[model samples]
Structure formats: C-alpha cells, structure tokens
Target: MTLKLSLSLSISLVLVVLFSIDTARAGYMEVTLLGTGTPKPSIDRFGPSTLIEANGRYFIFDSGRGVSIRLQQAGVALSKIENIFLTHLHSDHISGLSDLWLTSWIWQRQHPLQLTGPVGTLALSQHLELAHQADFSYRTKNTSLNSNFFPILAKEIVSEGIIYQHNGIKITAFLVNHYPVEPAYGYRIDSGEQSIVISGDTSFSENLIKHAKGADLLIHEVAAANSELLAGNPRLQKVISYHTTPKQAGKIFTATEPKAAVFNHVLLFGISERAVLEATRESFNGDVRMGHDLMKIGVGNELIFY
Candidate 1:
C-alpha cells in the first residue's frame, strides 16, 4: 500500500477508536453515596443522601447533612444538579436542603431548584422560605441577585407513581412504612438503560421490594438488630422498630435480586459491621456492600465502584 494511503487509514482508525470511547462513556447512570449514616451524628458518616447522574443530568436523593460538602468533594457542580428528591421529611434526610439551596444560589445557580417529595414537601418548602426570608430579602435588595434564582418549584407527591421523567430519566415514588411519620416513601430511578432503587427509610415493605425488582442497584437502609444501645432507650427502640433490621434487608435483597445491593443510612449502635454483614449474607447470595460517604458506582455492563 502507498505510504500516504497507510497514513490516511491510520487516521481513520484513530478517529473510530476515539468515537467508540466516547460512546461507551455516554448514556450510563452513575450513583454516589453522599452520606450513609442515620440521624445520629458521626464523624465518619454524615446523613442519608445519594447522588445519581444519568442522561447528562444530575438528581440527588435526600439532601442529608453535609450533602453540599460531599457533592463538592465528589466534584459535582451546582449547575449540573437538576433536581432534589426527599425520601421523607425526617430532619436527618432533609437537613442539607437549605445548605444546598443557599450555597448553590450564592455560586450563581441560574435555574429554579426543583424539589420533590411526599405530601408535606410544599409546606416544607414554604417553611424553608420563611426561615430564610431575611437572607433572601437582603441579598436581592443589596446585591444584583435575581429573585428568579431563588425560586423553588416544589412538587408534593400525592400518590405512588412516576413523579418525574425527562431526558430518558424517569423516577417513581412508592409508600414505605416509617409510620408515626406518615406517608414515607422509597424511590426508583430508571435512566432508560439502567435502573436504581433507593429505600429512603422504611421497615420491611413489599412495595419497596416490588419497585426494586430487577434493578441494577438497590441502596437500602438497615438497622442493627437488638443492639445494647436500644435496650435501655424506649425512644431508640421505637426508632429501630420502624426501621428494617439487617437480616430483613438481606431478605429484601434476595427478593429484589438487584445486580448489587448497598446498605445505606446504616444505624450501627454498638453493633459491629461483621454482625451486619453476616446477618445479610445469610439470605442474600448476591453482592452486598456496606455504603460509605463518597462511595461511587458507575452502572455500565457491569457495576464499577470507586
């Protein structure tokens, strides 16, 4: 073959390789655990939060404590955040909402913040607005801040169904039993090619198992069973009663049979990780991972964790 013809062919091959790489990187869902601990404060874990990136958009599930800090650590830009979903109105799960809203606004968030959750979400948004009235008023009056930037479009979920869908990303909310705190929910996000389920905070719910069925990833909450810490405190015991035990979570994992299962919002009070892992292993024959803040999963043909 002529040398010129050989050079042209080499260039064509290089272009093809580059295109293949780009295509492989696109159209996939990525999940990151922003926080993996419960309401109890811990130095290592923040609160219950996860970040989902798919279809060139970013969705956050539960803006728990330190969510903004974790998001910045994960190199997620405020501009890329399309919406925020709440599992429940539990203080631990929504504590970081204000931080995310106020801080992201300061950083020049030009679009309205989309907030979605159960029935009281609209009231919650109104409460937040009332809480920050002074700041919002002063900022807009003194600075060049556009009032539109502070606008929040809150969607109160009234029933179990598809709550949001856009750009090939669809999210569904279903009721979970975290009662006394009525109308709690679990969420399922389908990004066309792959799906993920987040068990916000619940006891054993058949509804959750139904939604999580055959998902690529399932991030569920787990509490230690009959811990010494719970024996004395009735309040703590009540909390534990409303949450799923590690073994129950394992059974849920088996029933759903996701490609991988992650235990998030872990409530470990005097219970070792070994105890929880062993309990889960009894029922779940598939991969089971304990979630930690900043942990990331890239969903492609296989689950890639970082």
Candidate 2:
C-alpha cells in the first residue's frame, strides 16, 4: 500500500474531531519526547527517547539523547521514574543513562530502580556504576544519598521472555529488526485497557508486527528521506540499505492494523520542504503521520489527536 496524502489529511481531520470530543483525554496518558532525533544529529531532534506515564507509576522506554533534561520537559523527576527499559545498546539510546543514575542517586529515591534491557545491560550497569564512582562516593556521604545510591535491581534479558511484571502493569520485550546491533527489541506495554507497542530503532519485520499487533499505538523509527538519499546525499546511499522506508512502515501498519501509528526518528517532519514525505505518505494505507518533540498521544486505537 502506498502512503496517501488524502489519507494523511483525513487522519488529521479525524484527530481534530477526536480532540473536540473530549478535552480531558487530552491531558491523560502523557507521552513526551525526551529526544526525537537520530544519528543524523538534527538540532530539531534530540536523539531517540520517549517517556510514558500513567496512573502513578512511570515507565520510561529508551533513554536516548538529552534524556536527563528531556525528563524535565516531560515534568518527570528522576525518582518518579520506576522502570527504565532499553531497546538496544546503541549509544544514543543509552548515553543519557549515566546522568539518570547520578540524578537518582542524588535524589536518593526510596524505591529501587528497575533497570531492564537486552544483553549487555548488566555490563552497561557496571560501566555506569564505575563511571559514577566519583559521584557515588561524594553522594554516599550526604546521608540521604547514602541509602539510595547503590540500591538497584538489574533484570538482564538476553532473549525474548518476561522482563517486567508488577504494579498492575506487565511489559514484555520481543526481538526486533535492527540487526548487527544484535538483540534489538520492541516492547509490549499493557496497563489495564491502555496498551501501546514501542519499536526501538527498527526496519520493517513481521516479528515487530507480532509484538505491535492489536495495540493502541505503534511508535516506530522512520528512516532518512528516501528520495534525498537516492538523489542528494550520496553518503547515505550506503546507510539507507539497513532501514525501513515510510512506505514499508505504512504497509506494516496496514497488516498489523495498529489503531494508530506515530512516526518517530523522523528525518523531515517540519524542517524540510516535505517532498520526500509526500512520496513516503503515498505508500501508507491507513491513518499515518509524523511527529515532533512534545507530540503527546492520548489512549485508544486511531484516536491519535496530534
């Protein structure tokens, strides 16, 4: 299926209608952009991090670029973050971790930090601890930090299995498409009637669809502008070989029938002239659009109101 402009416009109109229906939902299920860029390093996009908060407990997905400060933008402090889920070991996603660790320690949280991710997580935790040796040493003397700095639980996930099950919310990690960066995964998060699947930096894969199926939202990474790569950036010609085109993403959503799709890691949403996006949208069949920083999503399928 080709992504169609008419479909995109229709989806936009639908969102406007939905937002008009209930203004309260507009406030619930806060999904904030901690960072929205990729390796390309656009000033508009930070990196690739997302924050999802509901009820009382906070669940943080990938902690990509500027995540520490991004949390401030989301209005969530370090102690509020109960669980941190990493999709892979890519630097952008995990780079902000060291800052998070230090802040959590400085704040001296009462609850233990729940750190879970694919292979190398334990090793990464080790590196974080070592990296923060100076900070930890200083904070432990503050008495408050003494009790909270080192109290953490690390759940290492090498393959697909149950990673988190607690507090009326259960999250499962499934292998995804970003190969060569082995053991990459997408997460299935279910909280009562609210369910969302997050694709952490991946190309189109049936395996991802399996995890994303029947969910309220699918947040997937979009690739570089296809036309530009094919024409302008000769350097990216080699890079584009590994990712998913918007057309392909639309097809995946068409098959998965996700209630709605919010494209992240978007290369050209508000910055470029949008010629490439028009071509990409021509391939997606259902309601499809791109996102920017602070684009919040309310719960429910296809109820994507910007």
Candidate 3:
C-alpha cells in the first residue's frame, strides 16, 4: 500500500475515535423527581416517584400519584418506558401504575411493560389486569390493540443482589428495613460512568449505607421532624418508626459519602423547610438538597440541577 493512503486511513481512524469519545461525554445520566411526596396527598407534591435516564434509556423507580402527568412534563414519552421498579407495594408508591399502564396501551405502546419488585409484585400486576379486564376486552375487539401486548412482564425480586443488567446498566436491589412489608428494597443503578442510589422508604439501613457508599447521587426518604405536636401522637410515632428523620438521613449521608444527597418523599406536615434543611445539615456537610416534584438532577463529573 502507498504511504499516502496509509497516512490518510490513520487520520480517518483517529477522527472516528475522537468523535466517539465526544459523543459519550455529551451523554448525561439524568434523574428527574416525578413525585416527592408520600401517602398524605398535597397540592404541590404528588407521590414518591423518580425517573433515571441513562444512555437514551429511561427507568422509573416507582409509579406514584400523577406520575404520568409529571412524566409528560419532564418530556418523557409513556411509550419509551418498559420497566418500573417498585420499592414496596405501598398504595402511594404504586398508585400511578394503572394510569401508566392503561394510557400507554391506549396510545399504542407495543411492548409489554416489565414490573420488578419484591415477591408480591406479580400478584399486584395480576390484580390490576383483572380490574381492567372489561376495558382490555373492549379495546382488543374494537381497536387495533394486539392481545399479546396486554400481558405485563412481572419480575418478582426473590433475593438481594443484582436484579437487572442490560448493556452496561446494572441495577442492584438490596433489602431495606420497611418491616412488616417483608421484603422492601432500595435500588442502586450503576451505568458504568455514573451511579445513583434510591432509598425506597426505609429506616436507618446498614445495607443501604453499604450499597450507597461513594455513589454519584443518593435520593433518600425523609420524614418531618418529631416535634412537640407529634411527640405524643401514637400514629405519628408509628410513621416515624418505619421511616428516617432528616437527622437520621443526614447521618446516613455522612456515612455513605455520596457526591450529593437528596431528601425525597418528604413528609413535612407541620415542620418548615428550614427545619428540615437545618436537621440534615447538622450531621452531613456534603452537598444536600430537598427533593421537589419535577426537579431534574444530572449526575456526571459534577452534579447539575435543572
């Protein structure tokens, strides 16, 4: 081969390699908080839901109230989502599944939705399908809906470990202490370049601390401070027992040492935002912020908030 031709080919190969590196760098791992509230409904906050976008793929952490609406607001198409990971079967956490399922199918989403979570997830999916049997039957007969697409793929998480792996994306589910719920979970998503941890409604969990250590971002559930008003309330105590306070969450953040920590599923019934922030800052000196509905955060070399 001529030296001139060899030189030209080498230059072209170098350009291609540079272009690939630039493209990968331009891609971002974005996390959008679709709902940041709990069971107690609020006008501003919906329910506990989050969307993680990595490598052009989207994964939903939980399908909470108004998730479909918030997802649209975030510029995400319902058809693009194929799987949903539920921490537990709490009414508030899975409330928006019906809306997401029905709306996507109506809009001609051809892929079967995959729901992954603890043991009872399959049962939950079956029950929802039964409840919508009449609608499914009518839609199948009257419309061009494919009956094959009606069945949802339910993956029941039987043990603690890596539950999902596709391409370079790996999702690990670890047991959390949302006791009486048996097998509640917190998930860690590692997409080669970025890592995110979502604490799905748990108390101070050592397992979470182990998994979340040095994550790019950690989104943990936090409850309102136990103040004088809630001091004697048995119901309030029960709620607090099953969840983590901002102070406790802060300590966990300190231990885990993430690049940034977000307090989500905020149960601020009476306490002010100032109180929550102060409590979290008392222990954790890292970059910490409270989560709000529709808040967008990107994890890359540095944390970006949108």
Candidate 4:
C-alpha cells in the first residue's frame, strides 16, 4: 500500500508539472521582428516591420522595405495578415506597403487590407490604388482573384486614443515627437494580461512614456552616431535630431519600466551595437535587448526570446 501511494504521488506531481508547462505555452502573445533596419537598406536588416500574433490574429506594424520577403521567411502567409498599422508616413516606413498590399491580394486574400495610420494614410492609400490600377486590372481579368479584394480599407488616425479594440485586444495610438515630419505616432497593444509598446520613430516623447508604462515588452527605435562625426555634418545632425539616441531611449525605458525593452528601426551611423548597448545601460538597469530581423519573442509568465 505504501509503494502504491508513493507511485500515485509521483504521477500527480508529473501531471502538475506538465499542466504548468502547457499553461505557460497557451495564450501568450508572440512578437516577431520582421525587418529591423532603416531606409539606407542592409541585407542583414531589411526594413522596419514588426509582426504581432495574438488570439489567432496577425497584426503587422510598419510595412517597410522587403516586408513581403521577411513575412515569407517568417512562415506567415501574406493572405493571413489582414490588419496593418502604420506609425507614420515616412518613405522608409511605407515603401513596402504597396508590395504587401498587392501581393496579399494576389495570394488569395479574400478581403481588403485593413490599414490604419495618421491623417495622410487615406491619401496614400488612394494614390497606391491608382498606381496599381493596371496591375489590378490585369490580374482580375486574367486570374481568379476577385476585384473586390483589390481595395484597401484605410483608417486615418486624427487624435491620440484607442484606435482598435477587438476580441479582448486593444491598440492605442499616441503622438510622438518625430518633427518636421509632423503628427508622428506610437502604438500600445494590450491583449489579455500582456502588453507591448512600439515607438515608431521619435526623439524622447513624454507621451510615449505615459502609454508604455507597465507594458510586457517595449520595442523602441534608436539612433546612434559618433559625436565627432555629427559635429562636422549638418545633415547627419538633423537626421539624428529626429530620432531617439541610445541614451534617450534608455531614459524612456527607465521611466516606463516595462518588463523587457528592445531596440528596433536602428539607425547606427558611426558606432557599433556594443556602443549603443553601453550607452543605454548607463540609464536603464532593466532587461534590454537589441532587436534583429526575424527574432521572435514570446511574452507570457516570463519573456522568452528565440
């Protein structure tokens, strides 16, 4: 009887452990850094794009260069991604928008792509549609794709508020300081008990700090250049002025205190990744990581990066 009781206790403990593991794997939001580069273009870092997968829905933020290729590499079908959120309308940020939109329609997307962004988004969409009219006409006439799926449904954000709420997931857009490119924005996504903040491209905006607080993960942009180089080049200085330095990003990370912070849309001019990390470390003593293309992070009971 004693041996049987001991065996039963062992089995119960094993089941509990298995149950805990399953629980940890379930309902966790997945974030994939599709392209972590800027406008200049690098084979290593394609462009600025992030993929969020939660509740069986796919949300893409910022369709930059090589977005379609990155999505293919990530094993996500173009048709499966229907919602896209744009932070701002910079050339580097929207360069891949037409490709993703057109390719998805060709690849059998049954509905129009739901696009959300700042005030100029609608105009951009209209122009893209006009530009692609010949392609859409040819495909619909020669192929099986429905012309109905060729349109892009765009929502232009005019203010800072909750922009999307569906199936227990809420996305909020807030203003960030990316001026002379006025009306720049950042985004906060919350689903279940997990949250993520994406700072599109900004230079230390207090509004971002307010929305990023207590998020599970914060993906922010950073620009790094040697001070000596900037001293001689006015153009470089102006470019750096529009973005957050590693040190400034560190301050924001410290203020928000997210569980983990990551740097994406990296703009490193004359410095190395080590230099950027060290500069950020000076202000933030939290878990901070440099983002790379195709890097996957799963946020749940604990943060998992693979």
Candidate 5:
C-alpha cells in the first residue's frame, strides 16, 4: 500500500508539471522587432517593421525597407504570413510592400495577401497591382503559380475599433496624432491574458496611453537630435514636431505602465542610445529597452526578451 501511494503521488506531480508548462505556452504572445530604424539607412537597423505571432498565426505590422530580409533573418517563413497592418502611408513604411507581396506569392502563399491600413490602402494596393501587371502575367503564364493569388485584398480602416479577431487573438486599431498625417493609427493586440501595444509614430498621444494601459509590452517610437542641430535646422525641428521625443515617450510609458517598454523606429540624429534612455528615465522609472533588429520578446505571465 505504501509503494502504491508513492507511485500515485509521483504521477500526480508529473501531471501538474506538464499542465503548468502547457498553460505558460498557451498564454504567450511572441513579438519580434524585425527592423528598428526610420527612413535613414543604417546597416545595423533596417526600416520600421514588426512581427507578432499569436495563436499559431503570423501578422506583420509594417513592410518597411529590407523587411523581407529581416523576416528571413528571424526565421519566419514568408509564405506563412498573410496579414499585414500598415500604421500610415509613409514611404519608408510601405516601400517593401511590393517585395513582400510578390515574394510571398512566389513562395507558395495559398491566399491573397490581406492588407489592413488607413484610407489610402486600397488605392495603394490597386496601383501596386497595376505596376506589377507584367511580372504577375509572366509568373502565372510560365510557372505553376496560380493566377488567383496575384491580387491583394486590402481593407482600409475608417474608424477606431476592434479590426481583427480570430482564433482567440484580437487586434484593435486606435487613432493616433501623427499629423498632418491624418488617420494614422496605433495597434493593440490581445491574446488570452497577454497584450501588446505598438505606438505607430505618434507624438505623445493620450489615446495611445488609454489603449496601452496595463499591456504586457509597449513598443514605441523615439526621435532625438543634438540640441544645437535641432535649434539650427528648421527641417529637423519640423521632423521632430511629428515624432515623440524620448522625454515625451517617457511620460507616455509612465502613464501606460506596461510590463515592459521598448523603443523602436529609433531616429537619433546626433544622440546615442544611452542619451535616449537617460532622457526617458527622467519621467519613467520602469525598465526601458532599446529595441534592436530581430529582437524577440515573449509576453506571457512574465515578460521575456531575447
């Protein structure tokens, strides 16, 4: 009887351990900073792009320059990604769209690439189709690729609300102030008990704070320049006017109180990453990390960055 009881206790402990591991795995939402640079070309940092994996599905936030290469570096199969959400119609954010769309189709994407963005998204997709007409025809006529997958299905977000929900993953689009770029947006993604917020090129938006509250991870943009350069250059001043300064981002981070805060789309004209972090620490006391290309973060019961 003593031996039997010991055996039963061992089996029970093993079952509990397996259950705990499964629960932790199920609650995780994986995020990868595919590219962490702005319009300025950098060998270390590519253009702005992010990949979010939840419920075994892949979603890309922006298709910036070198996004395909970044995705390859992240070991994400191009053919597996079907949905892309654009923050705005900025050239740097959409320049790699053609490459991603065309290459994914060639790589055996089974469906039309689903693109969700602001008002001009459909028009952009239409123009892209027209521009790539010859290539599409050549591939379909000569290769085994299906012509049906040549077109891109784009949905333009007209208002702020829950834009996508599938397999327990929910994505919400909220308006952000990136004026005079009207209808710009930030996105909040929720899966199980884990949440992530991406602040898409905004300048201290209260709406972003509202949406980002208590999130597992908050990825935001930060821009900084040398004080003398900023004072002398009207162009730099105008550029900074549309973007969130590190200090301003710190305020937002403090208000949102996320489990982890990261800076992406880093645009430091003459300052260093340490300077940005120092400025942000002025207002926020929490841990802040400077996002690097291909950095992976997992949101679960505990925030994990790798």
Candidate 6:
C-alpha cells in the first residue's frame, strides 16, 4: 500500500468522525402541551399542563387532566418521567399528579419520584400519601416486585432560586403575581445556550417578563375576557379579577421582547380573538402566538419535534 493512499484514507476517516460528532451534538429540546384549559373546563379545552424534553430527559410542568394520555401520545414513556415541577397547588393544574405518581410507581423504578412545588407541598405530599394509600398498598401486595410503590421525594420552595439541574440543564423558579393564591411561580429552563420560560399560573405580572427576558421561548397564560363578559354569575367575575387579560399579557410582552411567546394556561383567545386583539393592542410587536391543546412549538438552537 502507498503511504499517500494511507494518508488520504486517514483524512476521509477524520471527516466521517467529525461529521458524526456534529450530528450527535445539538441541544435537543422539545416542548409539548398536555392540557390547555383552565379550572372552568370547556369541551374544547383541557387544563393547564406542559411537557419539557431536554438532554434525553423529561421534566413536566403541572399535570392537569389527560396529561398521562397526552404524554403517551407524545411517545414519552412513564418510566422516563421522574421530575415534576408545580407552579401552584390549584387542582386544575395538578389534578392528574396522583395518576402520574401511581403509574411511575407501577413501573417499579426503585426510587422516589422527584416532585418540586410551592411551600404547602409538604402537606399536599402527605395528603397524597394518605389519599393514595389504598391503591399503593394494593399494587405493592398484588405485584411480584419488591419495591416501595409510593415513594415520592418532595422538594418545596417558598422563594425564588435555582430549583433543579441535570447535566447541562438548569430550571430556575421565580415568584409571580397571583394574589389570593399567596405563592405562585414561573420557571426558566437553561440548556446549553438556549432558554425557555414557563409561567405557571399568574395574572399579568411583569416579573414573568423579567424572568423570561431574552429567552428563546416563553410559554405563559393568556386569559380572555369573553368568559367573564358572557358568564351569568359574579363568581366568574372573581376569576377574571385574578387572572390575566389577553391585553394585559400583551403589555407584558411589550416590556420584555422574547424570541417567541406562547399563551397556554386557559382558553384565552380560542374562540374569540377579542382578548388577543386587546393584548396585541398593547406595545408588544413580536410573535405572540396562541397555544392549543397538544400543540408543539419548537424554538431553540435546533428544531426538535416528536
């Protein structure tokens, strides 16, 4: 064999290796919506929930109705999901938590599920342990596995700080304005150079704007005034008093111009664009997108869709 031929072959091999490494690299991140409705359940909408996939792991934000099914539809296995972050303790945002806990427990992973939430998390965690006692006991006794079925590790946070981190991903939680609810939070996820922010459940709070500044993507709640305007009860009006008007959310977007903004908590501008229009009327000129149930919007270093 000629030395020149060997050198040429080595160069070819180096090129192949470099290409493979580049392909393997890339901050793979995917965001999938599980539920899009609020407490006022609608036939066309589910509750507030979202799934964040990054760096080969799944981190869920809130677990509303049909979340498990949605996750399955998104091709995410229950066993792969180990971390859950809750914005608040609202039933609409966390109603499906027990189901997630039970399903993961059924998989017998031999470890406590990671749950991060607000200050009252300890009490709620205790209640869940007690509430789901019969089911956990039944599974443990009836199954052949020898693992604790109801082991849940709770991490409660009462203030703003870094909540969770894995590999190169960082999830930082911050306080948001949602009065009467006492403590509410919004989370910013930093993976590599890309960042995404998820506003749990809050009114029109500029704190969210600040938290989500310069992020690649922002997913927050956009509430419509139609419900309050058309409802026949004062109770409905009270709900609006605490949540964001689409216009108010627009104003927030004005303050902070992110790469892209998505609204998903409630049925804000689904049927009527009145709320969205009101928000658009404000100062935000960027992309203010309306989020739907199970909708997937890719915004980051590289496009990821599943």
Give me the candidate number with maximum TM-score: 5
How large an RMSD does model 1 have? Answer: 3.1
| Residue pairs clashing, model 4 | none
Q: Which lDDT tens digits does candidate 1 get at residues 1-306?
A: 699999999999999999876666655788989999888888789988899988778899999999998999999987667699998999999999999988888777878899999889999999899999999999988887778978678999899999997777789999999988879999998875578999999999999998999999999999884556777888878878889998899899999999999999998777887889889999889999999899999987679998
Q: List the global CA lDDT of all models.
A: 0.88, 0.73, 0.89, 0.93, 0.93, 0.78
Residue 239 local lDDT, model 6: 68
lDDT of 3: 0.89
Please say which candidate is ahead in TM-score: 1 or 4.
4
Candidate 6 on 1-306: residue-level lDDT in tens? 699999999999999999766544545468888888887766556777888888788889998877877778777788788788999988998888888888866765556778899988878888989987787678768886545536678889968989887798899999987888878888999887778899887888877878888787888786665554547757656766677777677777777777777778765423475457545657677777777777886646544433
User: Tens-digit lDDT track for model 4 on 201-248?
Assistant: 999899999999999899999998998998999999999999999999
- Estimate the lDDT of model 1: 0.88
Full-model lDDT, candidate 4:
0.93
Candidate 4 Cα deviation (angstroms), residue 258: 1.3
Off by over 4 Å in 3: 1-27
Question: How do all models score by TM-score?
Answer: 0.90, 0.82, 0.93, 0.92, 0.95, 0.86
Q: Report the lDDT tens digits of candidate 5 across residue range 88-155.
A: 99998998899999999999999889999999999999999999999998999899998888899999
The candidate 5 region of ten consecutive residues with least summed lDDT is 20-29
Residue-wise C-alpha lDDT for candidate 2, range 1-306, written one tens digit per residue: 346988998899999889765543432455666677776566667778888876567888887777777777766778777788998888988777777766766675667677898888888888777766776777667565555447556778977966777665678899887868888888888766567788887777899887777877778777755464467766565455456667678777877787777778765423352553565567666666677777777664335464
Compared with the true structure, model 1 gives a TM-score of 0.90
Q: How far out, in Å, is residue 90 in model 6?
A: 1.0
Candidate 1, position 267, lDDT: 89
Sorting all predicted structures by TM-score, with the top scorer first, yields 5, 3, 4, 1, 6, 2
Question: Candidate 6: how many backbone clashes?
Answer: 2
